[model samples]
Target: MFCLPVAGIGASAYRGWPTRTGDIEICPIQLPGRENRFRAPAHTSMDAFVKDAADALQPYLDKPFGFFGHCFGARLSYGLSVELAARGGPLPQRIFASSCLAPHRGGYFGGGRSGPFTPETTDEEYMEELRHGCELRGEPTPPDELLGLSIQVLRADIALTCGYRPPGPGGTPLNVTTISWTGDTHMRPEEMDEWSAYGDVHQVLLTGDDFTHRSAPADLLQVIADGLPERTGVLTP
Candidate 1:
């Protein structure tokens, strides 16, 4: 199984979760341009970024596995599911997508997924948007090794976020079970409901202090493990 991190943080955020949850093996997928990979080239478009993640995990697709993504990571997971389907491969047994609404649920803010990054946006202005965005819900700040990389990644991600236009009010159509986190300022409740139209729905509402990532990683994993399709079985799908 794969546990993807939120935007600024890497797979290191899942340190609170078990390496193996019941029958599922947990492997947190790392985003490029963060952690030890700070020096790698960054991706500016959501499509390209998700493709990179799918490519990185292609070697491990020998069997069915669960996938989890948070915030921007969640956005990529949805796209990855679509790509995997297009390839006629074994899809995720379940997809835990948190902190982000289904792609088309909320109307596109910036431009929908069509154009390139915007210019005339200074780095400082971009950083302020991140600060406000992060403050809206709990998300991790960059560590020293990743501080600069985080800024770069967020800027690139914002370009995608600004340009993201969804398929419609309908959610993705992957067969995997879909999990969503509520109380996220980034994604509203009605938007979350749109996710149910996609597949099996499991909503985890994190109100109060738990609304943010720092206060909710453990709870997040628990939700994923407990809500998994099956703890033990033949593992055939």
Candidate 2:
């Protein structure tokens, strides 16, 4: 499975995940402007990002694979799948969307808010918000220098999310598994039912807080293992 990180963070977030979870191999995608890709400019357009990501993933598309994304990453997973299908490229067998509302819900942030912050938002405000978010996730805030860089990447990511427009009415549907954490305050499990519009959504509720996914618990792995096939096979062109 390809693991996409949450907003404002890097692929390193999944560093704790075992290299292989059951029959699934964990592959974490590294978006630009964060971690090792810090020098690369962050993408502010969903279409552009998806196109580039599809191109970059060509070699790995030979075998059956799936996507696992949390929060903003969830949106990217869905977008990539749609884009690949449009291009007649290989598609994922399943999509694991955790802690995110369906695209048609029409809101970047929870509670139908268009966006939480804008380019006009002051650095101090962004810092405070980031700190608060870390607190909520039970993690320590990054140092000032790192936080400053994170803010830049986050701003670009937020712009990408805000600018995205979901498909109208009936969009293409795929096999998807929507995951919700019992303690997730950001996106409640009950609010994610709209995902059914996108595909055969199998709703899964895990017992943990929002950041629990970072730990890659047994239950979460088991859920993922259950959704995937026991053997990997090549995708027919």
Per-candidate clash tally: 10, 0
Worst 10 residues of 2 by lDDT: 107-116
lDDT at residue 103 of model 1 (Cα atoms): 67
TM-score of 2: 0.91
Error of 1 at 167 (Å): 4.2
**Residues 1-237 of candidate 2: C-alpha lDDT, one tens digit per residue:** 889888889999998798887667888899999999999999998998999999989888988898999989999998898899899968888899998888865546643464446656788988998888788867888898988999898889878877888683357778889999998776788888888877678999999988899989999999888888744853322
lDDT, model 2, position 65? 90
Tens-place lDDT per residue, model 1, 1-237, is: 677666556677777666665577778776677777767766667677667777777777776677777656666677777777767765776777665566664323222432212344566665665566556555664344444556677666666655555554344455433444454444554545556767766666655332345444666657666766554432322
* lDDT of model number 1: 0.60
Candidate 2: give the clashing pairs.
none
RMSD (Å) of each candidate, 1 decimal: 5.2, 2.8
TM-score result, candidate 1: 0.72
Worst 10 residues of 1 by lDDT: 107-116
